[model samples]
Target: MTLTPQDRTIVEATQAGLPLVTRPFAVVAESLGLSEAELIDRLKQLKAQGVIRRIGAAPNHYRLGMTANGMTVWDVDDAVVDSLGEKVGALPFVTHCYRRPRALPDWPYNLFAMVHGETREEVIAKRVEISSLLGKACRAGDILFSTRILKKTGMRLRGKEG
Candidate 1:
């Protein structure tokens, strides 16, 4: 996509993250020497053009007492995976859930969900809850916890803007 100079300015200014304030857009606009309305309108236009998918905050769950994080993998029937995935994704404790291709003969898990807790036991309890929800559809499941914390960063738009 050919991004206008203003679009590039907006993306560069807010790509790091929106300001933590009552009027973040206004602050951003001031930085670019643009009006608040102009900044908001440009954002709406960007969304309409599909240049940006969505904007939201990603909180650090570990710092919030959720030290134990695990990605629970499930081997479910392909026929019912879509419905099952939707149900799992809607779960409050499930931060993220999605379907993935299974590598048979060696690996077989096709469904994945990420859940967090303060300890491994808590994460296991949450896994049990997920298993119960999956019921017989859950052919097999396992949780993979991280030994070290991972940093999450936003995507970067490379190259100079048009």
Candidate 2:
């Protein structure tokens, strides 16, 4: 999709992530020299045109005392993966869930879900819950606990101000 220069400014300003305060869009809009309504309207247009998927926040779970983070991968039945993924994704502990293509001869996982908890045991319990939810649909599953912190950055768009 083609984005106007103003849309590029919007994307660039938001790429750094919104401020942690009430009326974040208002602050951003003012910085971009645009009204809040104009910014909202342009964002709606951008979304309608599929330029952006959705706007949301990525909280730092570590700061929230969620130290144990596990990415669980499953070899689920192809026919039931979507339904199972939706169910797993809806769970409160799961931060992210999606289906992925499996690599042959080595990797066989088709579904992935990330769960965060205050402790390792809690993460494991969440894994059990997911296994129970999948039942026999899950051929196999494994949990990979995060051992190190990686920088988390969202999408970035190139623009004049960027």
- Model 2 C-alpha lDDT per residue in residues 26-49, reported as the tens digit of each score: 999999999989989999988888
| Backbone clashes in model 1, listed as residue pairs | none
Can you give the lDDT of residue 68 in candidate 1? 94
Per-residue alpha-carbon lDDT of model 1 for 41-109, expressed as tens digits? 999999999998778887888679998999999999899999999999999999889999999867899
Task: Give candidate 1's error at residue 39 in angstroms.
Answer: 1.2
RMSD of 2: 2.3
Candidate of highest TM-score = 2
TM-score of 2: 0.88
Candidate 2 regions with alpha-carbon error over 4 angstroms:
20-23, 48-50, 160-162
